[model samples]
Target: MFFFKKFFKKKKQPVDSQQTTDRQSVQSVSKIDKIGKGKSQTSRGLIKSNKLFMAWNKNAEEKKQRQKSGLVADSYLKQISPKKGFTFHSDYFEVGDGVAQILTIVPTKNADRQLPPFWVTRMLPRGLGQNVTARLIQPISTKTEKWTKDNEVKADAAVRQAYGERKVNDPSNQDIAFQVQDMHQINEDLRGGQYHGSEYKILLKAPDVETLDSAREQYKLRLKNNFRGLTVEVFEGQQKDDFENLLKSADAQIGHEKKMYTSQELAGGYYLMSKGIDDITGKYVGVSEGDFNNPAMLMDVDDWSRNIVVASKFGPRTGSYSTEVFGDHLRSISLWGVKIAEDAMIQNHRVVHFILNNTDIEDIGKRKIGADLSKHTSNINMGKGAINPFEAFGREEDKLNVYPTLTEKLRLMFKEMSPSLNDVDLNKYFTQLLKEFMEDKGLWKPNAKENIDTISLVGLPHNEYPLLSDFSLYLSTIFTIYQKQGNQQAIKSLEKIQGVVDRMKEENGDIFDKHTSSVVDNAQTIPQVIYDFASISERGRGIAMAQFINTLGYATQNLHRGDVVIIHGVDQLAPEVKEFVKDNLQKLTRRDVRIAYLYDNVMSAINDKDFNDLTSADYTLFSAMSSDELEAYKETMKATIPSALENSLISKDDLLYYLSRDREKVLFKLDLIL
Candidate 1:
């Protein structure tokens, strides 16, 4: 009770100018005495009232505590006290049960409507650790008008905040204009589509405060390790109550909460454990946990059917990843593919899922791809690494370095990865890494022309490398932090890498040019590059192909040894990116990174040069296919496929797919959630 009083105590307000000593002297002595007597009497009565209120509150709190501890469930209602069972502490909530505590996730910044697979993968239980269950509560629907109004309010607030923050440091309007433009684009996107906004809350329950604290710290570090832009901090004080309310309501709007997401990003994780379609009745059904355990939940429609049904508890299925078992309530397979593919393994091989669609340059490509890539740049692992690329060339351990070497070291540590470049010339790669890092830190002015010139020299297709791109982002973050602290080491680091690169180029001469011809100069204007993909001439498909292969030369650099890179929308990617994927199909498998490409255009994949290569897959699944595409696919694989499947009609009754790719090519009908 005393603790609660302290927790809820209000701060003292400033004394009124009229009540100050100088002004009080003007009052008569008798008047001052009368005022003091009146004040004393009022104070005594107020104190009595306060005491009664405190006593009432204390009693109510005790009852709530008892209910939360399970000592007393409501006699009439027989329900747990959802509203009263938790008390907010400094940074977490303490349950009345005393043993359990709750912590909610606070994102570092707002996330996109479509979250990338990499971001989704990092959220698995493995990343969250043991004894912690993450409950993601998202709204399934909302009225469009309310959604628009809410978003507009958020956008206005965001703009005002950005303007205020920028005004102090930057007199120039350029930064503010950019912020306004971004907000405008976001507003337009929110207002244009069937997009429903969502709030993300990861409710983590732990056995005790000590365990909760440890798990929270580890989870935060892991978040920083895996994700670039958005990690999470634990919700503090009243925020715990807000998050709890969110869990109970799911779709209810919480006042003044700044973070909002679109359904596209959050809905991918939606799943339901319901029975498959009924054979006799042809009806799909969902059973409650109690009903599932009871025999009467199942109905008998056939003759000579058993009257009784038996049910028993069983452990959840094993070896199957979340993606395989994602139940049939999804809006986008591509979104879910990214959501679930990270944790999947097939026959001891890591699986990478890629969804490919042809990029229509005039339409979605020019607008969406750039924005998408920008979103992913920070979503990918661009934080902390093992090596400090910015460290001065040669400083003795005892000598005081000009910069914070330790900070740089931590920042340079490539997201949960060892500093293994895998056949890449580390020197050359880091040189590029440093240049981009300097640009990010604002130490070097960004030069689009310089980038183009370099790309031209290296061959346009060879321009963008994933490893350098990610590492540069990481270094940029590190250098920016140091720069804010008034350190000039970023400048020195940039000079060092640039100097080394220049000298190397001088030494190598014309031999340094991997490809002599400049695709940018010769090839047609390339439109949009997604996921930080290098811009290249669309006409230079051949060049893009060459670059794609060149990029794969460093596949080992980008992908972890056991990574399953599930890439979706490969076709939407620029030619260079697509070609990189195409040429490296076999090479990626060799690096122990298994990749699965999902093409909406089945014929496109079938006609691909690597179509024969795909036949080597352990399983090829065909789902929701157009008649023509199915026929073409069947005809293309007829030699390897079984004769029975040629005549069998695939139906969507169970959302069934024809699975083939075994050596015998035996056709197997399978039901899948996607």
Candidate 2:
């Protein structure tokens, strides 16, 4: 009966045909309308309807489940898994498209200690399943040197060789043999040496416990046999401390030796200049051959070579040393003497004088007395216009006093007599004085006084005599020729010696009254003698005056007259000063030296201003920049232009422009331009 029902019964009877036809007609009309309007069926609409039905069914199921579980229909699980086989509880899948699944996995026993933390939802395959079910076994300490049959034979040979036929009784030999038997049980120790010998020690470290035990035994054996002669010292750690101590000791020894040798060499000493003074027959002296061998000495070549030896020859007088004589000579030695003295002073020594006059006293007295004073006294005693001897000597003294009454006159006489008194002459004069003084012992005899007086008159060495002599000869020759020619003009022009006297007065400011007055009087009178002998022009006379002015050290001041000198006529002036003088030569010709002076003053001002402006501008520019920037600017400027020099003048603006341009260009090249 159930089968018949299943086969024959219609599923359900259709509704009225007219009504269904009406419904189909309605659907067809709707489709036709939709097609006519270009509108088509939307999958979104179907999906929305399907989604609604599914959502409703899911809600119903969720409600049923909630009824059972007492949870809300819109719970988190329901939202995540809406359908069967897609439930959040079964698979636990992440719901959102972009959500990442994070699993916190705790470590388990049997996991490899080296493995990183694991993740249940891993990005990569878990490697080898965490190395589980495996255990690390402690390694057995095997014999480091395996004793194979052949190895054993070699070891036996080594032991025999090292033990040197080991005796059974000697304990040391037995110990050494035992050490040799275990060939691999030896350690190497290397050390450094002092002097010529080598001391060896070594350091070793073990990587494992087995290696550590083996190394210990080996070290013991090595100390017994291989290093038998060496002292075995154990070092447990770093050897840097020992090495540093050794290096310090070595350095100390080396420094000590170096210091010792240096001190020794310093103390040994060496010559600084030439070896001085071979003999002490006289006094210690420093003499130059030039002075002693001067041509004016009139001595034979051999004598002249030894002529002016300035020995520390001592006279009978106390403090009568050659140094004093030399010093006096150095001082009064004329212009050349003054120069030499100045040079000596610069070399750090002072000079004094001890001059010995060798003039004939009787001749000097006779010359003073004019005609024979002895004959005059004899005649007076014979009753021929009687004159007292005292009066005669008095007249002689007065006459002697009349000729250039000044110390310079006495100095001049000594200078003239200098060349005559060489070492031999001085020695002879001293010997004579000693003889005279000895004869009149304890009584100051007048003759003894004379002898001592002659020796006492020490002055500047006559060493500079030639210069004075040449000067005198030149003047005398000029005077003699002029007088013979009677050329008053030449004489007058050349004879203006007062110029020199005035210059001397200007320089010294009347320090020596007698000398100054005598020189001035002589100068005034000599021009008359020259004028009578030669006739010279005004320009010649001016040149002579200029020369005289130079001799008195006032050439520059006097010729320029404290104004512009128009040094165009003088080649000796500095070129720059000369140029200034020449540039204003026309003004000088206008007899208005003030114009030249003004030009000089203006030039000085301009130069000073130029220098100041350039310095200030440079300082400003340099100070404005850092050291590196200043250096860079200088390099750039140097590369762009020629060197700046004193002779070259550039306007301040132009220089600044150059410097600025260079700075800008360099900065721009370095990308530092602001």
Candidate 3:
């Protein structure tokens, strides 16, 4: 059935059919190219399929139309082709988006005589690129002639008013009593009047414009009353540069931006918002903004949103008063003390976050970005008026009493605090203290023995007890003790104190002599001496006391010569044994002694010298005897040569020779005894 199925199956299609299918596909491609003006070769098939080409063409046409109409939206543009003056434009449209294009025209021909014209332009909507032209206008020329005529009438009016008031309110009777003609005559007389009294002649002489003008008016009034022939030559000064003065006043006013808020005004305003103005035309063009909301804003303004906006606007320019409009968007936010203290922790974190996010702050030139952020954080956390726990001790008295400033204190605190040890490391504290002692207090000379001693006294104990190192009271007590008796005793006393510390140098030459040792080189010799004294005071005391007691035991035995007081072992002696013996004995027969044969074994191993030495009455060696030997010795009071010698006081060499003389005979006796 499988063979029949394989035979009946249709054969595969021929290569000619496949070639014909390929040719047909090629023909279809050629037909498509011909239909589209042969643009198919230039066009991407995939791009066409996705309709990206159509979109591109549509955008291209729109951009071309926009360019031709000069209506590119929200983009700054300048007419580069016609470079006569800058066509200023701005692209700012939305709440926070704007671009101002400024063109500076520098007069190359005459830099000093001709001022450069500044052109500024702005764009509004996102797609509008309309260029607006703005030109700097020169100030009007200063001229006295223009000022004189302009103010003449006002001056005349002022002169008439002054005269009328003076005449009406005349305090002197002579001023009131004088006729108008007489007043004019007096005015004329004063201008070129002859001296009547020689002594008082012309003490001061100057024409009072008000008085002269007033006299002229009074003279005119007198003439109307038929008082004629009253001729007066009034000297009138040229009209002052009143117009120029007016212009000057106007210029001064224009040059300066009036302060919007005084202290009282600021208090009442409830909110403050400041904006930077264009210098050329005093108009609000830019607002300063801070990256972080200022804490101060909450206290300054009652309305939270308004206060935030005002703070955001003005805080960035807190330290700056520049003609340039661009400044930090967020600078500072000042809050009331209570509010600030309450929110200090959160605000500090906010400031840190703001600084971290601000690209402009990161781009600052003088300080690293991380460093600036750290400084900002520190300011927010520990700055003046900040309620930070780390700075809680910064009261006025503490400030005065603290030898170091706050910065130094903080530095020392940071250096001494150890997160690893779960406590502050006092080694650093003592090191800082030693440094301060030398530098600030001038207590120690460089490399002086006293300085070294002081350091050792302070450093070693601090190493042992790090917790106590930073305690000023503890340090004071130690210093007091050191100052009174010097560091030697303190150093000696500290040797017994135990704590974790770096390995110390071995002082005595015995153990450390074998290795190439840093202790021998770096360790101070004086400290070693103090350590030796301390060691003697501690360990040596016990040994000495035991020796004293042993000495007393031997002395007691000597006093009762017939009686034996047996010490089983040298190792078993008490600390005071030697001292006991020295205090009581007239003389000790042997400097050293050992005891033997306790508990069926030798209590102490004694060499021939020591054994023979004990034969003297001052010392005794006790040994257990076998029951049989004891019985035999009790019956026979025989004294053999060896036994007699063993019992008697003999030279060490003589005792050795006697014991060695007949080893085999001794062995036979030892075997019989066993």
Candidate 4:
């Protein structure tokens, strides 16, 4: 919430004062009053949907509290006493069901030199033992020293040298060392109270106003009779002034909330459970204690996506390192994947469900009171041919690859693969739908006339599919975040490639002008010339394969160890596809990358006995229903039959939806079309 837009040092212009203030003011108000009454009226939080969050967090008491909290959500100054350093705090808080109190201490005139007294330090919790229990009070930060970079480097060098040639930055060992000695001091004043940071670091916490006062009296005595004695004060909250101010300055960052679970999210999770997902050690949530037992009301889905069904539960803090103990602590969870589909023949409703997840996130707390975490619910669609992405990508070599019209190049790719990359093809119309990507400098266009079929022969990079240029986009270091990256020579090479593509586009402009749609529509079958606009001699320089690969480096940015991905919808797998998949699969598996995919395409795409089965028992298979099957189930449910019979026939929605009676193409796999 404290993130501010970095200034762009562009040419100066006369700024509109009101416009700028308004832009910043809205965000500030929301942030500042995040825990107050105004927050409820304009209820925005880390979660994607408001209705879902309220269902989990909002209680009858808060509804009334919010009305009052609204008055102080902003720095109205009118309601605040308007004292110089004494802020008029509503002391608003979003803490779990309990009284909250903020304890403030005015430093004595000699406070800068003075340290925590011996008597006070003896009472504090030392991180070493289990007996120091946290109850009504939690001391925030208390620091008397700053860890400078110079000292850090010295510490690192010393620690690393001690390990005898071992890497200096072993994470766990480093963390433990840093936590213990880095930038910390043994407070002699408080009989060895370990403290950190440069400021007076007088901040502390208590559960209620009374405990705060008691803690203050005990500490204030140390500064007794000073010229300006330590004056401890207590307030109603624990949020920092800086954090509140940041929220007040920003516009709404929370996602729009929806009222009810979309038919898909609920139906999908429920159906998955029926398929034995109940054993996944999952979390069940709802508005109340009984809700977990009664799963019907709590639509189970979770993640950062907007306007979808989710299980009922309190969310966690948005900031992992920063704590906002004084205000609303609700946060959102990053979801697996989201898919939108129509119920088609089943109740004619819209369905939004979690995709790619094997089970819902495990609920760590009970349903009744309140939870400290800011997490959300999660689930995956488990239909026929369903395989867990995690299990598929269990070995690093398991791979997921996407190809447009793998005719020959696809073959070469397969020849390169190891045996590991085996995942089924979902065959939704997505992998071929063409992604809309653009470089700010327009690095998407490629030379159609210059085919890079052979890495050694091509003058420049080109696409085999002519129409791919129109729907075509490319990754190059030019306009992407990679712009201005690398050494001068590397940059020059990219520029040359850019020039080549520009020339190609220009040379073919006349053709596009005449046959735009016709040419693009027939990309797969079109002659190579349709894509390549000029001769290699005319194009001058060729873009290297390394350049292309370097540009695509960002694709792996989100990947991490043990993270899984499913590459689906690449239709008609060929030998090259297999080879490429295997090769990458092995490579990724070697690096612990996990993957998964549908297996149906093997039946239609690969009939050769020489090829090994990629979709065998190493992975679990879920028989998800296609949209046709869902429709049939829906129809059967709606048929003039008993409720018992209706429930038995419709097992689950396979995330497949038929746009019409006939299947509509699933463009980019953004939507599900059976």
Candidate 5:
């Protein structure tokens, strides 16, 4: 899903019910009903051709439908999809007929189904700032009108506790700083008067005078009676004014609203704009763009706190690094240096300075840094560890539903296919072939010899860049295959090379991963991984490719038959690789994956003979770097790698001298190929 602040942009592309989606994804919404009568007001505009999928937008005809359906003006709420993505197994409540909202049942563990208390928070008119909401429920039983109010108190408390415990936030600060403007513009754009803040009392409270006085104390301390204005005499029934008042409030009681997905949000790494609150300095503040670590306003906040005047605490900023950044889509890659001013800010990501350029480590290793000059630096040691621990994000691979047994079975079939596994003397050759078989399962990589460890691959004489590291596992299988599978010269050359290691093979040295060995130990290798791969029915291949190809992990439940999967970067791949991907992807449909031939990089380079087939379904490459980007990347590497080395063990002169005298080139800038 993509996030854009412009609400109107969503209208350009309504959801198509025919879109292929597994049963659970709410995104695969098939039908939408209007909140009121007018069967003709169904989602007729949503049934558009799939050609628009190229842009991958989430547009809707919600406003036009809202007008045509002539539903109550307040029925559509704010028309903003909640931040939390869709979810299933969550209870939803119906209102009258066609509309129902996703319900948030609380006091979760001890929830009493008989009296299960659920809460719903709807978006309010953007202009109001105070607590402008009231909870109203149409009871299904003799649950007293008082129960609705009491339920709301409990519900509101539970919601607050839930937010604190989950660290989830809404657009509170954004509402304060930008609401009035958003309200005015959205009001005109949506062409409705019900959306006006005065018409809705979303933040007003129906408290008695005494209740109002009690809540006003805190605001007095805040030097503003903000909460008091939210109180209003309780409105007992659902009147037109009541509906308008509550619609403008800060919260809502779930009623009817189908075709909606809501849940508590789970963005942990960085939180920029949570909400805006009055600072002791007596000004509203919420930052939108800056490093999460130290924005320009941080010092101003610090200085104010230290002085005798106003003291303000910037609750949090408006942007997030884990979730967002300014201008969007900065894809390639670069290394940046970090300096932490305070230990408390350790986890914050700061993209500030470029410290090194020549990123060519081969050149750096030749000359040593200080005492460590005693040995060459290894990528294993210098390679940065994997980024943040994503477990909290619900992406644990172990927990990911993978087909471990079938995956192993497929591995075993690979071994039985190798020609030399029959003879005891071929045991050595069998083991070597086993490794090749497994490596071949990683289709995203080119069909060539590759070390299981990627750093080692780069250490080879000629290594491809962009690393192709993400999907390496997808193309591999059981027994390692011959360098050029089924080629006689390559096979003899392989045996001849292993023949020299014969004496060593006599000793027991096995390289199978525990899980891999268990499956292959059972026998029956496939004729060859590629042949087996190609021989599968297009139906089965589509299923396997979709299921197995994931950045999350190798193990996953097989995709159901007919499920489509898209292979990216296909057009830009080397000729042979492109053909293999295309041959395998024929059975899938466009809905499975977008077969784009251009990405951020160059899309049409005159240099490649293969550029003629820019529309080939075989390639995933959307675009390649332009001459300028490629040239800049190359130029940056030339300087950065050298600067990085200057700070390393050896001096630049020593590295150049060593490169000029001993090595053909001390370091080949890998990205130089881009």
Candidate 6:
């Protein structure tokens, strides 16, 4: 019974004649519609939907067609194929028989010391074993508008955050007081504009890859030791392409690696004009013989190098040293006892180079050396074992150990000749002997009295002639003692001693006056007379060199518009000498003279006040510093940097990085030469 009921339920019931006919027609029509629409039909004549399935099948067919055409499989490969502007090249190239690679030197970010670009070059190596060339490509200075705007934006945001909303009715403005102060401080620190971005490139060359690699490592090590804050990187691969593009136009809109620096920074130590190569505009000064007077000779060609007069404070002396004299008689000039202890060199139409030691001891020691007299006096003897004159003279009595026993013996002889002489008479004879000794030693000059009067009338300080002043004081003491004695002969003898002191002073004052003029004049004509004054001590040589500079400074006050004077190796000069040169520099520049002063190990002198002023320059070039100098310089850097920067605590390293990155900071001029 259950089976029959299920069968009956599943079976279709018979209908009335007209209705059944209509239903069959409807079913037939539905089936036709399903076939046309791509739908599947069921066994019971019911319609089924499969639209999603059909659409998916269509997509699959399209994908198959694309794969067959090779479009889908190779799409990623197309992206990596060689393009129009991409190429690979090594940074190194073969030049003659060796390989050369160009590298870039940049200041390290947040470095404690912003080492100069030239310093990197110097660190690379020098001499015949190592060959490297550096090219400094400086673009215009970097623009500060973006950095300024960024600061303004940050400041505005900070203000907004601090004050979000303030009501007029608020009891006090204390809530944002710290913020206001910070803002004000920030404004103060950000007052100045920033300028930076200079590019330094170096070319390294070696005979083989191994040697080149070794040199590269050595250079890196040197940089680390000498300039810990510097960064060196090879300019290779795509970097070269970018650099080339930058060279074409530093301000181009396209991608590039160019950095902009001011003209002054670029010109600081760059050989802008290669002497003869760039000396086309001026009169021929002849090829530089790389002599001490090269600059003098070249500058003489200009009209400004003549008619120089001594500075008023230096006394009424005229310039006797002429560049023309140096040029006309290059071989005949007599150096006239001029010698320099420090390493200094001057090249015509080139830069002056000086190597100054960092130690004060060396400077003092150099000044103390008077001459090499052992050669002349070594073999000489007071006939057969006679007591040595210098030995007989008590070193304690001769404070400077300057007088010999012969001098004392001579004084005694004079006293003996006057048997009835009193103490006053003995004093007179001793003074006369002293004067004669001074004359024999070339410390006394015939015009000593005239020079003395000149110096006294000008009110010059006694320190200018320290040794002479000491002698004069001794004589004056004796003169005072005999003043009451009324000893006329003693008075005369004491006066002669005064004359001796005056003569020595006069010689020092006039050392440059006649010696420089004579040397410059006869340098070209009488080369043999170019006496090194070897008999003079190193101290004497130092003194003479200082005087030479003094004379040149005063003598060439009215240099022509384009005249250039190069003063090198001044670090070893005495404090007084440096001051004198500094004053003379002003005199030289008062007209149109351009002065180039060269110094080495300048970092050591930066802490010294006198040297600080000396280093002040329109343009400056620098090299690597010693480790000791670097350590000392760090303290200076710490003091120089601002305490805070951009709402953050700033370290000395940060300040130096900022200064180097943005050269126009208060600590650095926009045109500073690195």
Output the TM-score of candidate 3. Answer: 0.15
**Positional deviation of residue 294's Cα in model 4 after best superposition, in angstroms:** 10
Clashes of each: 21, 34, 48, 68, 87, 27
Candidate 3: where is the Cα deviation over 4 Å? 1-143, 146-454, 457-463, 466-674
TM-score of each model, in listed order: 0.27, 0.14, 0.15, 0.20, 0.18, 0.27
Error of 5 at 607 (Å): 7.0
Q: Give the Å error, residue 58, model 3.
A: 21
lDDT of 5 at 115: 16
Q: Where does the lowest 10-residue lDDT sum fall in candidate 6?
A: 1-10
Error of 3 at 651 (Å): 99
Better candidate by TM-score, 1 or 5 = 1
lDDT of 5 by residue, 1-674 (tens): 00011111111324568766445223323322222223453354334323233222334354356556765544564344333432222222112212222111112121111211121122111212243222222211122335433543554454445445543355453433243343333234333111110111222231233333333333223222222112222222323223332333222322321111111111111233312222243211122121112112111111111001100011101222221221121122110000011111122211111111112222212332112211311121101111111111112232221123223322222222232433332334434443343344331123232422331221111112111121122223211354436656546644543432231122211111111222211111211010011111222322223212211121111222322121211222333223323432332222231111222123222222243233222311111233353344335324232443233213211101111111111221111010
lDDT of each: 0.38, 0.25, 0.24, 0.27, 0.24, 0.37
lDDT tens digits, residue span 456-552, model 4: 2111123322332342244342235345554554344334434433443455332211222222222222111111111221222221111112111
Q: Which parts of model 1 are misplaced by more than 4 Å?
A: 1-98, 109-114, 117-130, 139-181, 187-197, 248-256, 262-674
In the range 1-674, model 6's lDDT, one tens digit per residue, is: 00000011112335657533436435545655566575555644332334434544566577678777787557766676433442334756554556656566555422322225443234434432545433344344354667545755676676677686766767545645545654554455445644334455555667766777776666666666776565567755634443444453234312324333332333333432212112232322123221111121121112222121100001111133332422321110011101111101111221111112111111122333323322221121111111111111112322232232234333333332233445554454664646544554444434554543221211122223224344456667767877889978877766654554454346543331121222222222211111122222233544433324323422232234544544333444555345445655565466545554434334434544344332233323222234454455445443343332321212221111111111322121011100
Candidate 2 stretches with Cα past 4 Å from truth are 1-486, 489-496, 510-674
For candidate 3, lDDT tens digit of each residue in 405-426? 3223323322222112211233
**Number of backbone clashes in candidate 6:** 27
Candidates by lDDT, descending order:
1, 6, 4, 2, 3, 5
Compared with the true structure, model 1 gives a TM-score of 0.27
lDDT tens digits by residue: candidate 1, 239-264: 54565466543244344233444443
**What lDDT tens digits, residue by residue, belong to model 2 across residues 368-390?**
32122222111000111111110
Error of 4 at 566 (Å): 2.9
